[model samples]
Every structure is written in structure tokens, then in C-alpha cells.
Target chain A: MKLTIRKDQLNDAIQQVSKASSSRPAIPILGGIKFDVTHQGVTLTASDTDISIQSFIPVENGEFVIAKVERPGSVVLPAKFFVEIVKKLPSDEIEIEVKDHHQTSIRSGSTDIQMVGLDPEEFPVLPTIEESESITVPGDLIKSMIRQTVFAASTSEQTPILTGALWNLSEGQLKFVATDRHRLASRTATVQAENDYKFSNIVISGKTLNELSKLVADDNSEVEIVVTANQVLFKMGNMLFYSRILDGTYPDTSKIIPQNFKTELVLHTKKLMDAIDRAYLMSREEKTNIVRLITQEDGTIEISSSSTELGRVTEQLEVKEFKGESLRIAFNSKYMLDALKVIDSEYLFIGFTGAMSPIIIKPTDHPHSLHLILPYRTTG
Target chain B: MKLTIRKDQLNDAIQQVSKASSSRPAIPILGGIKFDVTHQGVTLTASDTDISIQSFIPVENGEFVIAKVERPGSVVLPAKFFVEIVKKLPSDEIEIEVKDHHQTSIRSGSTDIQMVGLDPEEFPVLPTIEESESITVPGDLIKSMIRQTVFAASTSEQTPILTGALWNLSEGQLKFVATDRHRLASRTATVQAENDYKFSNIVISGKTLNELSKLVADDNSEVEIVVTANQVLFKMGNMLFYSRILDGTYPDTSKIIPQNFKTELVLHTKKLMDAIDRAYLMSREEKTNIVRLITQEDGTIEISSSSTELGRVTEQLEVKEFKGESLRIAFNSKYMLDALKVIDSEYLFIGFTGAMSPIIIKPTDHPHSLHLILPYRTTG
Candidate 1:
């Protein structure tokens, strides 16, 4: 494509699609970013079989002309060099032209880089999303939900299905649930969606959602998510992200969270997080990562962790509120820290179902978010 | 030790000595930080045999009391736990008490940590510097000199002596030279020392100097370096760093640098670095990391690199001053980048004897720093 484009706009477009470009492509063309240039704008796309990202640049953005096209054409350039060189280029505008045999020349300031380009026809075309069933959510909310639930997804490939977060939509409410069997994180949000759209069993890879989170801004600006049988597409202003759904059924984690509580306590989230973090230091060194929480009759809680050879650390905290019977429990400190970190409230509610059952934690004032962790069976 | 000390002061002390504390110490005792507490203040020391660092905190700095001594004692606490827990502790003042059997209790705010302390008698004692000969230099200048030369030291253990930087002190000049055989970096500075004191064969591990670089601030404050037969000590205001000198003969590299130059070119450091950096992108992709620089018959130079399958990048630049004969030279781009990054001058002088000879680069203004790299003999 023969065009001179603003370097900043081109840099942003390159960065947006770079995440989907494979470092070691199974097919050589998969490592290249395909550019389709026209008088309307330039579309840059990259894909690696599982995910594809495309970004668009308009001819003019208000008063500033983003691109001046001499001829409309297509070519695929190596993503690594294209991405890095543009960021380091010295000038405000960069001229890219396709020469004989698809060789591309990028001229900016004093540098002239001639990169061997691939035939655009060799690049895999992104599968079109045909389904009209779509849900809209604020970019900020989706980013937050991904941050809260994605980390709990299993990192191991032993059970490939657990590596994705299950997305469910019904009655204008969108919920995300992720579990690795030991710990689970579930977050619910009221999305802008059709009332009768009841969908379930949609498991999107946590890795894909995490990348999407980085591309989307943390603003209330809207994003439309169109879902098909095996693929999902997210539309953000000038960018489009497409990801393939994992080909398995996500487990029903409905019964994992404890319902009845024997002991319930409320504590300042930051304070509790601080105390547990200190205890986590010892547990991490032990590699067991087990820390104990004990509720006392004196209206307080003690957080402690001990190593056989390294001694113990204990924090006596005067909780904000407490109720129900007293109990002692042990759970993975790292898991607890992760769950607590996502709670955005001043205080958090923690409920224990008699030490053996799963512990449920939630923001004190909200019913939309819940975190559950299985307790360690400690002989106390 | 039984003292209530300011957490910030203690934290700073912990961070300073932490580098000498090995993550996987050879002896169990070496994994602990020895606390020598007296009525005056507290002294923290950590060592992994090869290097030891000791930092002192006094009872008072001017009118502000840093620590209130309740009892005089000594104990060794596990460095891993002690360092992290103190940083996360809730209060400013931490109360430390040594109980029966050397059990240490550290109480701060609502948290209480009891660590198994090793017998202080088992800790290695820092060696006392016996030599009266020493050199003092500004901390900022020494730090700069280390940064400029240390990266050239060999990371491989095959030539153990090349892993250290040779320190040569003659008259009032202190010099550092490091080489991994392929390239060499040398930096020199006049020191604040006795004019007749001359020392040589003091080679400190590059890794040790890198750690020292992190600890010393970028200020023109004075630091005393005391040298003995096999040990070197750096005394900052409140911290003392002791390192063991590597035992081996450094190779004589005096004859390596070319004094008779056929070509001399001076160019803007930043502009040349940028152009070469772009060319490096292609070379890095090819994995050979080789970039070529050719001085043209025209009053300009060209920086370029190419991959057999990926094409080429060329940057033609205007020169401030070029008196070099037309010659083409290739070198490892990464080594050149490393050398250019440490130059504190706006312009740099590059001298070449021939296409096959060593390339010498020095700051255009002064002779405080010099870098030499062997050119790749390209069959062209």
C-alpha cells in the first residue's frame, strides 16, 4: 500500500494488533500484519489461528489528516520490525509503499527500511461473526470483571476447559465465573443487553480476555460482544478483537460457594489484606502457602502462619463487625490475597461454614461479587 | 535485639545489606542477618562468604532518636522473613525482644512475629582491613565509572578472572577495565587519594560492583575504599561494604588498542545510536546481531543490516565532521549499543585503523572513557 500516515496513529494501530501476532507462527504469513490501504482508511490485521485483531484508521481525525493515500493496495509485513521501528522512527509522518514483488519500503526522516513483505492472499481471513445475538457492556466494567475472575482460571493444560472463564447472560445481568477447583472467583454485573437473551456455557479463554482487557480502556465507553457458535468478537471504537471459544463444557460451579455460615465476620479490606500479606510471607517461604484464621469469643480475629523451622507470625485484628459461632480455619494465603485484592469496597464480608466447607467472601455492601476458597483440613 | 527502632531506618538498613545475603546460602547461618545491638545503636550484617555488607543505625541522628535500647544483645534472624515482614509491618516503631533460648519477638502495632534466631556466635565475622593504603572517590563518579565498564565483564565462568573488572590505581588516577575478549570497556577518574599510593591487581567481581552500584546514591558524596591484600571495603556514611577480590592474573590488554588511526569521524551520539538501533532490529531478528557502518565518498555515512530472507534497512546520515577514507565495517550491534549507552557526551569520536582493525569509540570532549570492539571480517 502506498501511503504516508501519521506515525502516532500508525503506532497505536500496530500496538493494538500486535498481541494477536504469533511470535513463532505455524504458517509464515501468520507472523505478518496484513495491511489493507484505501482512500477511506487503512485496516491493519493480525491473527494466530485462535485470535485475530484488526484496527482501523480514518482519513482525517477532526482537523488533522491521519493518512494520504496515493494508491490502494494490500501487503503483509513482519510484525516485529514494523511495530518496533515505527515507535523509534524520528519523524511525524512515515511513507510506506509496495514495490515490485510485494517488497515494502518504509521511509521516515533519514531512515529507509525495506522489509520483504508476504503476499496478502496467503494470510488467513478472520471468520466473520454472523450471529445477531450480542451483549453490550461498559469497557471499564468488562475490564474489571476480567481482572477479578481471570486469575482464578487454571493455568495447567491438564484440564484444558478450566483455562477459560464461563460467561453467562440472562435478564440483562452478565456474570463471569472462573475456577481451578481449589478456588473460584465469580463476578456479576448489570450489562446493557436484551432482556430475553439467556445464554450459558460460553467459556472464553482467560488468556484471551486478559489481552482484551489490556486493549480496552478503563472508561465507561461501550463495547459490543458478538458471540457465535465457536467464536466471539469484541468491538471497541476503532478496534475489533476476535477470539475462539474453548471447545468444551465449563463445570457448573453453582454449588461451590457455601450458603449457610457458622461464623461470619466483617473487616476493613485494606487492614485485613495487610495482615494476611505479612502472614503470607512466611507461608510462601514454606511453599505450603497455608495460613490460619481463628475467630475468638472476644469479638476479634487472629491471622497467623507458621513454618516448622522458621517460627510464626500472628496478627490480632479488631474486626469491624462479627457474628455467628467461633471457628478456626486454614486456607491458601496467596489465594486469599488474590480474592481480597479485587474487592473494591472499604470492608469485606467473610463467612466460614464450620472450617471444612468452602469459605465465601464478598464486598460488604454488594451482592454482585463473590469469592470462594476451599479450606485446608488442619488437625487443630 | 531488645530495641524499639524507627521502621524506616531499619528498613533502609535491611535493604542495604540484603544484596550480600544470598538467596541460597551455602551455610544455614549465612542465610540469617546478624544483629549486633549495643546501648549506642544496632548494627546489621549479612554475608554469603564471597561478600559481606554491614550497615549501622545509631541511637540518635542529631536530636531525633532512631532507636531506644531496652537491652544489649545479639542474634541472627532469617533474612528472608525479617526483610519482608518489617516492610509490611503496621507501625513506625518496631519493638524487638530477645527471649529465652534466643527466640526473637518482633512486635509492631497489632502484629507479633516470633522467629527462630540462630546463635550470633556462628555468624562469620567481617574481616578487618589492615592495609593503610586506600583511595577515596566521589560516589557519583565511581558509580558512573562502574556503569561504563562493568557490562563488558565476562558472564561465563570458563575464564573466572575475566568475570571481574581490573582496578588499576597509579599516581592519583583510578581506572577500571573490563573485557569479555570480544570487546573491552575502560573508564578512568582522578581520585582523592595520596599522590604516591599506587595499587594494582585488585579485581572485583562485576556482579559485586553491579550490586554496589544499586546501593550507592547518585550524589557527589565521599566514600572511602580501603584495600588490603585480598579484601576491599567501601565505607559510606553509615554502611560498610566488604568484598573479596578475585584471585587470578588479569591478561595484559595494553597492546590491543590501536594508537595509529587511518580514519577519524565525529557524529552526534544520539543520532548515530538511533540509526544503528533501527538497523539492529533486523540483525536481532536474524540472530547474528550484526550491523554495518560504511563511510561514503559523499560527506555522509550509511548504517544498514540485512537478513537473507527478510531484506535490508539503511539509514543515510549527515555528518558533523567526517575525515575517514571510504571503508565498510561490521560489528555486533548489541556491544555497540551497550558502549554508546554509557557515553555522557553529546558527540563521540570513532577511530579506525582499517576495516579489519579494532574500532575505538571515545567521547568527543574528554578521555575519561573509551570502548574497543573487534570488527567482523566480512567477505565483501
Candidate 2:
């Protein structure tokens, strides 16, 4: 296909779709980005076997005109080389043309690059789902939800379903939950949907979940998520992000979430994060990276950790309010730090069932974000 | 031993010396930094056998007074843990105390760290060099000279001497030369030395060369270079850097640098660099990353390169001056780019002897920096 496009716009489009371009593709044609041009604009598509991305650039916005289109066709040029050449092409406008034998030529300023292209017929076609089963959610909310819960997904390859984040919808609430079986993160938000869908669930691979998050903007823009039997598509702005749904069943995490707790404490989020981070420098050498939390009689939470091979560190923090008796518990500092970072609230309330039980952390101001961590067994 | 110091000062000192400490060491005590406390000040030393760095923080500028030191002594604390703890300490001032059993305690704000330490007697001590063999030069000029020439040194361990930068002196003029036998770089400047001190030579390893460069400031600070038979010491401001000299003869590179050439061209450094960089993106897939240059009779230079597996790129560069007959040559673009970045000049003059001869690049304004690159054989 022949097209001329602005450097910045083309760069953004290329980067967005490049996430799906396979570096080591099982099929040779999957390594390239397919370019399809029509009278309206040019569409760029890239896909691995599991995920696919597509972007479109309109004709008017292009810096230079795609002149003398004797024919309209599609071809696949090397994605990486073409992108790099365009980025460093030294000029504001670029001209691209495809010949009869798929010989692609790109010219910008004083530089000219000619590359052999592959026939577009060999590229795989991405499947598109119907819009009937789709739900609309704010793009910023979707991006925040993914970032808040995706890190908890299991990276271990033993259980494939655990490597995916479970998305569930019921009534008017949408919930995102991910657990590596050690620690679980769940975020719930209200979204717009038609015809009260009943307990529909889709488990998306953690990688695709993260990549789809980047495609969403932090503005008030809305994105439509269309779910089919085995595929899901996220349409945001001018980009389309598609990923294959995980096949296995996800474990039910509802029963493990604590409903009753004897002790609860409220602490400033930044203060707790800073205390844990300071303690982290010392405890990081240990495998568990465990840090002990002690609620004092005077309403102070003391954080302490030690490694026999490295050293010991203790930090004291002030809590806003405390109930029940003084208690001490130990948990992975990294998990606590990660959970604390996504809370988005100034203050957090932590609920403890017992020293040996999982501790639940929730924002005091906003209850939408919830984080749970399993305590580590310590001699103290 | 007991003392208190400012967290920022302690952190800076530790970071400076920590560069000399490696995670793996031949001796156990070598993995730690030796802290010596006295009524005057506190000194910290770290070494990885080959190089050693020391920084002293006097009591006057320190945050806290040297508390009850019933006895003055020294002990070695694990360098990695100590540095991290100091950097993340919560308080403005950190208190450190070492027990007779070699256990050290550090307290800052509400955080306390205790670590196991080693006997300072077991650590290898750096030998003090006599002051008579020292040559003083401006720190900024020395740092620039090192940066300009050190990159040309061979990185391979097979030829140990070639991995070092050669220092030669004649009539109070100091010159640094480095080469991998393919390309050579040399920088010369005047230094303060006795008139009778005609000549001396030393070769410092590239690893140490890089560390020494960091120690020197870019400001007009004075630095002393003290040379011993086995080791060379660089005194910059309050920091002391000592490195073992490479024990071998350096190859002479003066004869290889071309004094006169049949063709000469002067071009803008930035423009030439950008063109070469663009050509690099196309030729990177090739074995040598080779780019060819053809000086046309019409006063423009044609740059081009191609990869059998990738693609081809061609660019034209307008020249300000062309003094000789038209010529064509090919060279590794990366080497030229490196030389271009280090030369502190707006305009660069390139001297070409023939199609397959070594090309010399020098600054039109500054005569101190020189870069020589060997030509690559191009197939017709």
C-alpha cells in the first residue's frame, strides 16, 4: 500500500501496534505489520497468535499526500526496520510507495530507503466480535483497574488460569480480581451496561491485560469492551486491542476474603509507604523480604525486619486511630508496598483477623480499592 | 568506636567509595569497607583488590559530634548493606557504634540497623605513594582527555596491555593514547612537571581509567597524578583514587597517524553525525555496520549502505569545503559516531589518504583531540 503520513502520528500508531508484533513468531508472516490502504485512510495491523492490535491514520491528517494511487493494495514490510527508518528519516514529511513486485520505497529529506516486502495475503486475519455483548467503561477507570490488579496475577507457568486476571460483571458492578494464590488484589467499580448481564466472566492473560491497559488513556474518554465466547476486544480512541481469553476455570476467591476482624488501624498512606520502603532496603536480601508490623499501646505502628546475613532495620509510624488490643504481624514488605501504592487515598485502614490470618487493606476515603496480604511466619 | 555524621555527607562518601567495592572478592574482608574513626575525622576505605577509593568526612562539617570514643579503632562493615542503609536512613544525622566483637549498630530517626562486621586488620591496605613523582593537572582537562581517548582501548582480556590507556610525557607535555589496533585516539595537554623530568610512561587499565574519570570534576579543580612502579594514585579534591598499573609495553601509534593526505573535507559535526546515525540503522543488520562515502565532483557527499537480509539506505550531505580529488571510502559507522561525539568542535576536518587507508578526523578549532579510523573493504 502507498501512503504518506506525519512522523509523530505515524510513530504513535506504530508503537501502539508494535506491542502485538511477535519478535519470534511461530509463523514467518506474523513478524510483520500489515498495511492496508483505502480511499479513506490506511490501517496498520499487527498480531501474534494470542493478541492483535490495529490503528488507522486518516488521509487529511497525513503531512504529505499519497499521490498517484494507480492501484489500492496491501503489503507487509519489516515492522522494526520501517519504524526506525521513519523515526530517524530527518524530515517532517515522508513518502512511501509500493511497486508491482512488493518493492517498498520510503523517502524523507535526503534519505531514501528501499525494502523488499512480503505479500499481504500470507498474513493472518484477526477475528472481530459483534458489539451486542459489549460493555462501556471510562478509559481512565479501566486503565487504573488493570494497573491496580494485574500485578497480583501469577507469573508461574504451572497453573495457566492463575496467570490471567478474572473479570466479573453482575447487576451494575464490574470487579477485577487477580491472585497468585499468595496475595490477592481486587478492585470493583460501577460501569454502564445494557440489559443487566448475569455473572458473566472472562479471564484474560496477565500480559494482554497489561498491554491493553497501556492502550487506554487517563482522560474522560470511554472504551467499549466486547466479549465473545473465546475473544475480547477493547476499542479505545483510534486503536483496537484484541486478546484471546484464557480457557481454564479461575479459582473462587470470595470465601477467603475476611468478613470479621478483631483489630483495625488507620494510618496515613504516604507515611506507611515510606516506613516500609526504608525497612525494605535492609530486608530485601531475604527471600520473603518480610517486615514486622507492631501496633503499640500509644497508637504507633512500628515496622521492623532483619536478615542474619545482612542487617536489621526498624521504623516507627503514627496511626490515626486504633481499636482492640496491641498486636504484631509479619508480611512481605514488597506486597504491602505494592498494595499501598495503588490505594490512591491519603489514609488506609488495615483489618487483621489474627496474626496468622491474611490482613486486608482498604482506602479510608475510597472503598473501591482493596488489597489482601498473607502474613509470613516469623519467630518473633 | 562511636560517632555521628550527616546522612547526606555519609551517603555521598559511601557512594563514591562503593564504586571500588565488588560483590565478589578474593578475601572476605575485601567485601567490606574499613571505617577508621579518630578525634580529627572519620575515614572510609573500600577496595576490590585492583583499585581502592577513600573518602574522609571531618568532624567540623559533620552534623553530630564525635560521641564518647573511649577508644579509637577501626572495623570493616559489609559495603553493600552499609551503603543501602545509610542512603535510606530516616534521620538527618546517623549514629554509628562498633562493638569490640565487630558488630556495628546504626541509628537514624526511629530506624535502627545492626550488622555483622569483620576485623579491619584482615583488609588489604593501600600503599602510600611518595609525593616526589607526582604531576599536577587541571581535573576538567584530564577528565576530558580520558573521555576522548579511553573508548578506543581494546576490551578483550587476551591482550591485557591493549586494554589500558597509555600515558606518555615529553617536555612537560602529557599525552594519552588508546587503540584496538583498528582505530586510535590520542589527546595531548601541558601539565606542571620539573624541567629535568624529561619522560616517563605508564599504562592504566580501561576499567580503572573509567573510574578515575568519574572521580575528576568537570570544573577547574586541580588533580594530582602520583605514579609509582606498581600503582598510580589520583588525588581529586577530597577523594583519593588508586589503581594498579598494567605491567607491559604499549604499542607506538605515532607512525600510523597520517600527517598529510591527498583529500580533505570539512563538514558540520552534528549534521555528519546525524547522517551517519541514519545510515547506521540500515547497516546494523550487516556484519560490520559498514557505511560507504563518495565525495562527488559537484560538492556533495553521497552516503549509502546495504544489507543482503535487510535493505539499503542512501543520503546526500552538502559540504562547505572540498580540497582534493573525488574519492570513495567505506568505514564502520559506529566508530566514526563515537569519535564525533567526543570531539569538542563545531566543524571537523577529515583527512583521507586513499580508498583503503586510515582516515584521520580532527577538530578544526581544537588541535588536542584526534581520531583515526581504518577503512573497510567494500565488494563491487
Candidate 3:
């Protein structure tokens, strides 16, 4: 296999596929990135059993000349070192030649690097998924959805399904919900779809979604997501992201969300987040991460937390708007802060259904995003 | 104690003094920052036994209004939490009041944080050094000298004195030298001194110098260096940095640096450094970190490194100038790279005594800085 490619193009392709490569793989070939060169262009693929990514660089596309092919062949090289070498190469163009016995030579400028390449036959093939049911969504919206809900997913593996975010599409509205039992976050967006196809239980690992989010372009580019029986594929530009769906049912978090509230408080998002963040420092020391919020009769909220070793912090914020009855509630400050950060609005509306029930938070302008945090029982 | 200080001023003072506060201090009070508020200004001090730093914020200094003293008193507050609180405070000016029972209340905007303060009497006093024998030097020069020589200090604690850089002053010239047996780096500079005072065998820990380098202002401000029986104090601007001297005799490294060389190579510092850096990646994986350099008869040099698992890399760079005889030598690429990084010149002149003797590298423009790296005996 022999190919000449632009350094920047090759670096970008390697970075895209290298995300799927594992530092310590169960199979040695999983740690390698497969380079398939053909007359059309070159395709780089990497996989770690759970997540696989493939990036293609066409020989010539309009104004961009990505690569030039001399011979059609394939080989697998150690992803870690190859990526580093490609990034640090001096010349604008790099020439890679693979001789017999999988001996590869990379030359750029005055440097010549010979790397041992593994046989391409040993590397795993990309998983094939049917593109029968696919939904197209804006890359920017999907990235925002992933960022809003992925952090709420449980990191613990005790219940493996909880470590993934549920992707449900119904009636042309795609929803992403993630919960670790303590708190829950959900984001909904309108996606273009043909017919009334519904995907109810497509739960993808939060880790995979986080990686996919990074690949999503910030522009309003369309991303085609194809869901199969066991695998899901996201196609954007010349990149294909594939991940296996979790094998379990996601909990029915909709039932836990409170529909009614005893009190509702509207305040500036940044102000509330800052106050809770400071209170969290004290509560974090106590390990409980519990911060109390008390609503006064004068339409003001008091945020405070105390630790035996670290004294206490008290902050008062004037509510912009208040409704119903005044109430006091205690919840994990980290959960509140996390929920507040994802709300892209100036003002936040928080609804509490009694002190023991779950509290719902939503941006005043963005009703499509919802966050719920369960209150902690406090003796006070 | 009651005082109102600007958030930026308090934050800077806390950051400066907090460097001396250790996370796990031997004495609990040592982890706290002592605040002495007088009619003139407030002095913030922190000590970790080996090193102590104090920063003063004056009440009124022309355009810089650092702090205002409402009442005069002293107290020591936990450095970690106080710094964090000050950074996150909302208002521009923070009001701190120390009540009875060592309780401190810090108010900023609508937030109030109360922290438990330790007794100021329990904190260690700053070491007093007579300024009669002090030398004033530009802060920028001392910072540069520290960066050029500190990395060569031995990290292993087997010989405690080797972990410190030897500071020698003679005839208005200040010299700093550090070596880890295999490699040595020395830097010399002319400084203004009173009389013909000479200081020798004064070794300061490389770690302390590195910390002091961070506190050094980037401008041409003068820094006063005061040396005593067992301590060295660096006074820059309104900050005083005190560090304890290492106790031991530094080995004479002058004899190892050969005056005459069998080979001399002058090339672009960046070009050679880049070639060696690439070779070092392969050698680093082999656990030898040895890169071979061979001077050809045509006045060009070949750099290469090979590993059984990672194959090999070979690069040839054209030498701008070469003298003496052609020679081949192998050395640790990391040491050479470290030395090249600190050279403030585009071209570097390397002097080799022999294949086995130490090689000296110096910038063509800078004669005050010198770097020496020992050769590795390669089987090939």
C-alpha cells in the first residue's frame, strides 16, 4: 500500500478515528488504526468493540485535495504513535509506503520514519447496520442535546442501562433522557423524519455520545442517525460513528417527574448558580453535598450550607417572580448546579412539589429542556 | 479585625502567599495565611517551614488602592478556602470582620461566608535577614537563570544538595549551577553589588527557585537578594519570598567541562532539537532514550534511533558549519532537548571533547548560559 496525503487532512482523519481506539484493548488489533487505501481515497477506521469510528479522505473534492493514491491496499498501524508522528511531521505532504511483510515507511521533509504495520486481516471489520430507519438532525442541536443529558447519566455500572442516555423519537420529536436515580435531565428537539417511525428504547452509552458530540460540527450541518436492532450509526460529512446499544430497558423516568408544584421561583440563572456553587463548597466537605434553599415570605430565597469542620455559608437572592406558597427544600448542590448550567437562558424557573418530592427546573425561554433533582431529607 | 479590600488585590495577595502554604503542613497553623492589618496596609503571610512568602497590600499607593484598614488587628485564616472564597466573591470590595472566638465573617455582595480562623500567634514568624549584604538584580534575569539551570537539578533525594542549585557570587558575577551527575547546566550574570562581597556554597532548592520564578514579575523591576547563615530572601515589589538554604558542599563541576574539543558543530537550534525530539519518541519507548548523532565527511549530520518493537527513525540535517574531525556519539535525547529549549539563540554551537566525554552546548549569541550532556555508550 502506498499513498500520499496532506498532513493536515491526515491528522484530522487520524484524530477522528483514534477516538475509538483504546489504550488497553482486549484484542491487540483494537489498539491499531486500519488504513485502507483505494483509487478513490483512503479510509481510516478504529474500534474498541463498544464504539467504532471511520473517517474517509477523498482523493479530490472540489477545492480540497485530501489524498493521492498510487496503490490500493490496506494495513493496520499502532494508533498512538502513528497519530503523534503524523501531527509532528514537518512537511505539508506525507508519503506512506507499505512494502512486503507489512513494513511501512513514512517520509516527510528530511525525516524518514519506519513503523511496523500489522496485517489488515487481523483487524475487526466495521459493523454493518441497516439504514432503513434513520432520522436526520442538525449537528449543533444533537451536540447540545448530548451535552445537556449525558452528564446526568449514572457512571456506576451496577445498572448498566443507567449509564446510557435514552434516545426516543415519536411524532417527529426526538427526546434524550438521562438519569442516575438521584437526578434526571431531558432535552427534546424537532428532527426531520419520513413517515411516523418511533424509536422508544435506543439507549446509548453516555461515553459514546460524549465522543460523538465532539465530532459534531458546530455549524447547522445535517447528521443522519441510523438505528438498528443492536447497533446505531451517525453519519456526518465523511465520518461514520457507530456504537452498540445497551441491552436493557431504561427506567420510566416520566412518572417520577412532578406535574404539580406547591411553589415556583423565577430568578437569574447565573446568580442562582453562583450562590449554589459557593454553598456547594461547604456541603462538599461534609460529603452529603446537601444545600438548603428557603423561600421567604418577602419573595426572596436563602441558600445555605454548613459543615462541622468548615463553618457555613449563607447567600440570599431576590426572586424576580414568585407564585403559589413559600417553601423550604434541601437537595444536592452539585445536581442543582449541573442542571442550571445546561439551561441556556437568562432566567430560570424552578418548581417544587413539596419538600420531599422532586424539584423541576427549566429555562424560562427554553421549555424544550427540563431538569429534575430529587430533594434530600433534612432534619431542619 | 475589620477591613474592606478590593477583590483583585486580595486575590493576588492570597495567590502569592498561598504558594508557601502546604496542603499537608506539619503544623496545622502553617496551612493558614496570617493577615496583619495595620493603619498603613495589610500583610498576608504563609509558611511551610522550608519556604515562606509574604505579600503587602498598601491602603493608598498613587493609582493603586489595594486595601483600606477600618480597624487594626491580626488573624490567620485557612489559605485553601479563603483563596477560593475570595476568587468567587461577587462584589469588587470584600468586607472581612474577625469577631470573638476566632470567627471570621467575609461579606461580598449578598453572600456571607464565615470561616474558622486559627490564632495568629501560632503561625511561624518570617525569618529575618540583614539587607546590609543584599544585591539588587533585575527580576527578569534571575527568572531566566532559574529556568535555564533548575531543570538540570537531581530529582532523586539520595543527595539532598544535588537537588538544589549552587548559587555563587564573586566579583559582581552571580552564577547558578545544577547537575544530576549525568548532565549539568550553569548560568552566569553580572549583578550590581556593594564592595567586593563574595558568596559561595549557598545552595537553594530547585523547587523553591521554580516557585520563586513564578512570583517574579516579567518587567525590569529590581529584586533584592539577601543571604544569611541558613536562608536566602528575595524581595520583589511588595512581595518577600524566603527560602531555607540546603546544607552540604557542592561538588566542583568545572573540571568536567572541557575547554578544548575534538569536534564542533554549529546548526539551527530548532532544527536539531526537532530531529532529536522525534528520535527520542522511539528511544523513550525502548527505555534507553538514546539517540545517535553521526557527523558525515560532507559536513552533514545523521540522527537515528531504533527499537525492536517500534522499528527505527533516521533523519539527516545539513550542518551550517563544522570543524575538527568527524565523530559519532550517542546521548540521551531528553537532556539535549531540555538544554536546547532554554538556549535564547537561533543557532547553537556544540563542543565535543570526545565520543565519551561530556558535550557542551551554548547559544551563539549568549555566552552566559552553558549546557553539558554526557554521552551514552552504545554497543553499535
Can you write out model 2's per-residue Cα lDDT over A275-324, one digit (the tens) per residue? 89878777887877889999876778889988887667778888888887
Per-residue lDDT tens digits for candidate 3, residues B1-380, read 99999999889989999999998877779889999999899999999989999999999789887677788999998888787878888899999999997899999999999988888988897887876788889988999999999999999999999999999999999999999999999999999988898899999999999999999988879999999999999989899999999998999999999999999989999999889889988888788799999997777999999888778899899888899988989999999999999999999999998889999999999699999999998777
Q: What is the C-alpha RMSD of each candidate to the true structure, in Å?
A: 1.4, 2.7, 1.5
| Model 1 TM-score, all chains together | 0.98
Instruction: DockQ for every model, please.
Output: 0.84, 0.67, 0.77
Question: Each prediction's TM-score against the native?
Answer: 0.98, 0.93, 0.98
Pairs of residues at least 3 apart in sequence or in different chains that clash in candidate 3: none
Per-prediction backbone clash count:
0, 0, 0
Instruction: For each candidate in the order shown, give its overall lDDT on alpha carbons.
Output: 0.91, 0.85, 0.92
Off by over 4 Å in 1: none
Q: How do the residues A4-93 of candidate 1 rate in per-residue lDDT, one tens digit apiece?
A: 999999999999998999999887899999999999999999999889999999989999899999999999998977898899998999
lDDT of 1 by residue, B1-380 (tens): 58899999999999889789989888889989999999988999999988899999999999999999988999999898899889899999999999988899999999999889899999998998886877888889889999999999999999999999999999799999999999999999999788689889899999999998888866768889998889999988889999999999999988999987888889899998998898898899789888998888787999999997788999998888877477789999989999999999999999989988999999988999999999888877
